[model samples]
Target chain A: MEIAKSLQQTPSSYIREILAAASDKNVISLAGGLPDEKTFPIDLMKPTLETLSEMPEVFQYGATAGYTPLLNFLTDYFQLPDTHIAMACTGSQQGLDLIARAYVNPGDKVVMEAPSYLGAMQVFGLVQADIVTVPQTEFGPDIEALRTVFYEQSPKMFYAVPDFHNPTGVCWSLETRKQVAALCEQYNVALIEDAPYRELRFSGEAIPLVSDFCPQHSIVLRSFSKIASPGLRVGIVSGKRSYLEPLIKIKQGADLHSSVPMQALLLGLLKHDNFDYHIDTIRTLYKSRYETLYSELQDKLPEGCEIKPVDGGMFVWVTLPSCDTFKLAKELLKDGVAVVPSPVFYPQPEAAKAALRLNFTNATPTELAEAVSRLASGLAKAI
Target chain B: MEIAKSLQQTPSSYIREILAAASDKNVISLAGGLPDEKTFPIDLMKPTLETLSEMPEVFQYGATAGYTPLLNFLTDYFQLPDTHIAMACTGSQQGLDLIARAYVNPGDKVVMEAPSYLGAMQVFGLVQADIVTVPQTEFGPDIEALRTVFYEQSPKMFYAVPDFHNPTGVCWSLETRKQVAALCEQYNVALIEDAPYRELRFSGEAIPLVSDFCPQHSIVLRSFSKIASPGLRVGIVSGKRSYLEPLIKIKQGADLHSSVPMQALLLGLLKHDNFDYHIDTIRTLYKSRYETLYSELQDKLPEGCEIKPVDGGMFVWVTLPSCDTFKLAKELLKDGVAVVPSPVFYPQPEAAKAALRLNFTNATPTELAEAVSRLASGLAKAI
Candidate 1:
């Protein structure tokens, strides 16, 4: 069978396959950046199911912009006008795909953060865009490098995870975000600020989106997958009317709309008194697990190894000196533990082969400790 | 604001806007091709939602293919082997979009039925494909015309809704389907068999999909949105392993996956004894309403006006004599009646202006009568 030439060249998601293989076991899997299912407000959702069942059309076809009530809820929650918001399914990945479709023509230039979410990189690749990854410093991306890249590529958009950045878990500082926003404004480039983990702040005050600087040019994406239920496949896109209206049109062509029942249920949960209370509880739960894993890695890992403790979100990023982390990850999986190989997160695979992302949210405290111990042992053996 | 250049050309869904505008007390909208909400198994979904709430992780990020249980249920229901299945959100529109992304290169040659589903045409158009629509005869698309077009264009794919086709509400005869399938096989052309209205058979024996003739080269899409709840956003795609695999990859990039809670709830509903009973109940309900519509139009419509009494599905495709449907539709809107101008369904906008699509599913029998009377009055006055 002659497959699509593009698909023939496309690589299947390695993380997706490994996650599926580990699902049936007690594999201490930290590979997938999934929120702990124990924290998803199922009790609140239980009543929500019943409430939405009363209006069956709520379980039927909805506007492509997503369910109106949920969009309204998100607009109010994000402090954006109703015109600035549109919702999507599949966490923030669908939002990324929409951005790719609406903005990037073939061979168009796009700038992304080094070690950003693997899925976003894949989206850029699928659109056949020329992607330049600007290196991130301790707090955020290097602004000077961005300026050089902008001059070289004349990129149309910069895709960034400003809050609790994926794979690396570094949030942009308020000043850095403003700086980048100003640069984008200077270059007239769009900023795709993905903040799927914005609300899971275990520490630090929440910063307003980069959209604050140039509302018309900045597109911000937030997802329920981290704070609530990823299985619901709900995410919100907020930007100025100029960017959002085009996105809504692209969304209609893409999926007609997101799931109506899921949006209705999410709206019900949001309206419930216990919604914020449950998110607070989840924050505390993940905070302890993250702290436990961070300490374990710091103590057990080799002296030259570095670990970045995430302020929020599910992951803890680790870098090892002179070790094949991907090989070590496979060895750890053999020991019934799994950590995502960080090479998958990069535009060029060889650049990030020595790093790994360990998710602390889904595992229990003991499991998190045991998983890190296994990784430590595997790293020692591999080195 | 410098918007992405790609969006500058992508046409907005004209039908979707009309659907939104018609949501009022006076508007009798026939614009949306929606399955009747009253006929859906809404009550049965109550327990399914309750059961889903118990599994919190079901609300978390799901497998890229879809929820496993739903996939398994759909596989068994469709009687297809595991190798040939994929799941999509909302309906098969997403499936079509994913297929377009995976297979279509810019400026590719594609083929379509003369007046196929506008949504599918919208997708092909977005990919910048040159589409040739074979004229539809009473039986189906003209077989000889298809052969000529297929040979001339050597299209990337032939998109057709053979099972109770959309807009026209015409099902291709099994003989025509086989002839088309055999021709596709001979020419090495891929076929997309979109069959949302398959089980909505008002009469006549069910025809097995054309894919059964050339499964290796065809993608068959079915949806629960028509027979069940569109709000859940569940649909099934089945074809050769070679075709399905690429579609699955596209699915991964498109939305990670559909909602797990919705998928699980749907799987639970499929397990019930009342599942087929509910489908039959829908068939009976729609059949009666369709008859009422056909009789009313026949009685009230002016001489020389043509209306097709469809065997299945939710719409009645009408072609008025010597009247501009675009203008008449606006006039009808003023008189509290609405219909979609059928020219929008055609690939070439200049092909027809006298046709319109009236939906029978959403309106009640009494409401249908009033709507049709208004349509008659609108037509009589306009013509």
Candidate 2:
């Protein structure tokens, strides 16, 4: 059977291709947005794992929304108002898919930062959404450009990652958060606030989620994959009941519901006394790795190449002097390092500036240093 | 926010509404197609659950295809051809959903029996497939009608449940299976064989899957939800590598694969020494419940009400004298029994015959008898 027209339009993920190549034993991969396997809070989850056999009900089919205990807990955990609710999904990735499926009609305009979460772009692309882009500033999205898009295009939704963003690690400033939220409210476009890296903040205090300023006009996709375990494939989506009900309905057909055992396990871990401390440890560990990658890049990158320090999250973005990044990435891989070229993060790859996204959370300080040496030497020759 | 136009065409699941009402303690519900909670082999799964913490690899991000060990085991266990492969999904439900999303474009002709799986209709509806239906018979689909549809419409695929089919529990006769396979091959139509209840046979010898006859032209969906635990949400889709890759691509955006821990847990349960015996016990238990409901309906059902005995699977369909099944179902609920009305099962509700799908698995023999009592009296009043 021929694949759907929609699937044909979706570019196979470049990161997946590079990651496949990066698996060579000699290569040190900073190409993937993988949380270090060692950082998984397996010990914190052990008590729940052992107790699951006793909870036979979890092994039965679950409510389409989620397991009740988890949903109830999340409503309070996220401080959702009576009008709002929470739904558990296979992952926040699925939550994003649901949003696109539920709300994005073909040709509907969906706004996003030019370099944004690739998975988000994938989902919206599958629905054949007309994805419009705005530039990202150090603070957040280029707010003036955003206003012009909203005013002219009148997009259905503006998708954003306000916490330590994937690829860029740019946390939206509080002022930017409020401004984006206000613009959303004014334009009546739904705000899809994706915060997969919220708890990974290492050096900076947390800023309010952009959704907080316009809760009535926003939906929040929160993930435990970073602080908890992605292998469990559990995440939470929250918004006003009216906003979330469509997603819940779509979810019923998406996967029935997420794994109940995973949900129950997540609830147990959340209730554990040391779960908060577990997040702290992930932050400290990732912070150290980020520092190692940052300092190494700063020292070795050729003049005119630039690097930015991140307060938290998995990646450091390096702005290279204009060059063919795909070729550079391939050459760097031959030198025993793997990184994602910036074009893969853009909806229109040709519009992307010369840059590379290097992940810090999945490697050690020594490995990070070696990868940078390979990257710098490779880049110096290319530039 | 208004839902997308695609979602707008999809009907809200009437089953959900009836299931919610069935939750009343006073109601003996046969409305849901739930396996008995007692059937879950939690004890058999315990050893794996307890040891999951020791397997840190299962707690990290896994391949989008599935957990490696589980995939390898299933590929071997199913005895798939060298060119065939297995990929795990959130459930067979997701397997169906992915097939629709990956292969069916809006207005693509997809074939199914008139009264078919609601979830299949749901996923297909979400993708705007132009569903074409053939009438079903005691043997399987009406062979003449199926042939006419396939030869004339040339649907992209024929979606079927060849064993102990849902709603009707009409396990196809061997001849019918072969005939359907021949028609699919002749028409060059893809066969989507969904076999969630294939293993639940208790009274008759098992028949070969329709896919066995049309292996090169089919994709098979196998579910453990009935034989194992639905809460784990693990199911397998297998076909030639070319046929399965598109689904794996769409699946990356769907949920980035099913939960890895759930996949691991399913793998352990499948490998347990007593797993086959556990299935035997479920078969025996459901057989007894089916007998009780079948006999009670035979003795007490109103004149003109017709019932069929099922050898396996969860439900028995009762065709009634021409009347409104929705009204009959509502009256039965008030009489303290809950059953799914036949109309709810159809893509076009008005085309459904007046019938009720009574589940025998979740309720006990005693409860099944009582539910039939309520159903009989309510039917007598309605007719």
Candidate 3:
């Protein structure tokens, strides 16, 4: 039977495919953007689950927006006005789906940064949005390129990972964020700020949300998948309540609500003083992992291959010298190393290629050093 | 900001809106179709959570198709032949949304039972499908009416809650299900069987699924929100591998996966020897609740009102004599009683005006009797 035309339009996510294909018993994967399992707050989670179990409401269907306490905590955490937060089931990916369903119409233009989060691109493609990829400089999305795309496409919305972006672990500069916000206001484009990695910053001070820059037109999304636990599938969206109203309605029709027990656990965690302490520990762990991976790549990778330090977040983006990342990745998988090619990050094939996203978060420091060494040796032979 | 015209076309769910409005502290809620909290299988669930917590994989990002063991259990439970099953987050509501997004293109013709599940109606409406409701009879959907709709609309699919139907509380006789399956096969239409309440049957042997009759063209959905735990948000969709393939793709883009921890807990419960014993206990309890509700309604309902016994499910479908149930519900709520107007059950307005769905499962026998008594007295005074 023919699948729906809309799904036919959505290319299966390459990261998912590559990850699945690389599931060999031998492969050490840096391909998937998975948070290191060790970073999960197991000690705290054990106690939190005990507390959640005591509250029977935690195991029942919750409010469509979120579990009441989680929403309240998020509102306070984001320091948004009261009642401006909503929780989502799964990752922030569900947030993307809800936003697209709530606001986007078929054939509407959607401006996204080139080499963006593959999942967001997949969601936009499913919505049948005409995708326009704005160029990206090392600092984040290129402000001038964003302006051109906004002017040319007059897009309904612009999607970005302003804080420690996916695939390329570069946060948008504070000035660039204001410029983009100003352009969005000028062009009447809605801004979808996905900040899943916002809390993972190791050294940088927090940048004020673009929602502060463009309050009416912005929605900022956050997820526990990064710092807390992805297994619980809890995410939050905060913004102007006006923009959130439609999203709530969409969420109501999607799932009655996110899991109440998960939300309760998250709420319990957020309420504790240790939440900040946990995030700090995670930041330090990720930073050490990043250093180990970066050093190993520097030592082992052949000349002409280049790597850059990630300001924050779990990934280290690498560009191999004149090599097909996908083919090299496949060959490396045979030799027990797996990495996601960079081309899959773009909305369309015509954009660019020749890089790979290596996640340092999921691997141990020793494993990271070994994987990078193995990948370099594999690439040398394959090239 | 104006929501997209597409979302505009989808009507807000009548059940959700009424339930939200019925949140007044004084109002007795017969409005929501929620199951009794007392039957939450807390004993079983405690063990499930303990087992799940011990499993390290429970706190990780799972495969999009869902936890493998749960899928295996569901495939066995559904008695499908080599079918693929995927888990949905929150509840079966997300499953419906996935199906809508995966298949129902704009203006696609859909055939649904009149007075259908309001949640399904709302999702289909959002997909912009041309919805045509087939009249529901006491035995099942009106077969002749369905044939007529099929002839007229050439619908892409038919949606039904055959066993212990929603709002109406009527089960399609086995013969009727067989006939509907034949017709769907003849017309080349897919059948979406929503069986959240199937296992909740108070009496009678379980009817074989619509998929048993037409596996190739059927999708059978099940939910733990009803039997296991709503707050944990676990649901499954099982069908031929062919269709399930696309649905999995849709779900992947939608939520990535259901909560791994929740799935692990559910799988543990299902594997435990006490699982069936727990179901038996719930069934016995709900049976008593149903009897109490039926007897109370008979004793207290206004003269011309009728209440019928439902073989299974959480609801008692009541038809009031010549009174508008919506207005009567409001009057009853003022008297500290609440009921959902039956009109919301229908895909369109007219079918629901004179009826209301009273949930017998969610409340204790004493509470059910008292609510019914209040409703009877309020009905006498209102009309």
The local distance difference test score of each candidate is 0.81, 0.92, 0.80
Candidate 2 lDDT: 0.92
Indicate the fraction of true inter-chain contacts that candidate 3 also forms. 0.62
lDDT of 1: 0.81
Span of 10 residues, lowest total lDDT, candidate 2 chain B: B324-333
Top-lDDT candidate index: 2
Residue pairs in clash, model 2: none
Give me the runs in candidate 3 sitting further than 4 Å from their true place.
A321-323, A381-383, B83-89, B351-353, B381-383
The total number of steric clashes, by the backbone 3 Å criterion, in model 3 comes to: 8
Error of 3 at B349 (Å): 1.1
Question: What digit string (tens of lDDT, one per residue) describes model 1 on residues A1-383?
Answer: 35556556656677876787567586889888877777878888888777767887786688778788787777777788555766655467788888887878767889998888888877887877888889998779999999988887789999998888888889888999899989999888889988888888899888878878877678888788877788888888778777877777777777788888888888888888988899899999989999999999988997667897678877888887766666777778888888888778888877764788888888999988888888888777776
**DockQ for every prediction shown:** 0.66, 0.90, 0.67
Superposed model 2: Cα runs more than 4 Å off: none
lDDT of 3 at B147: 91
Clashes in model 1: which pairs? Answer: A59-B231, A60-B231, A230-B60, A231-B59, A231-B60, A231-B61, B90-B233
TM-score of each: 0.96, 0.99, 0.96
Instruction: Kindly list the per-residue Cα lDDT of model 3 for residues B1-383, writing each as its tens digit.
Output: 56877788876665565677677876667778776666677677676665555676768888888888887777776666765455554578888888888888888888888788888888888888888888778889899999988877888999889978887889999899899999999988999999999888878877888768998888888888778788888888877778777878887778788788878778877887888988888899889988999999988888878777788888888877767777777778788877888777676786554877888777777778788888888888876
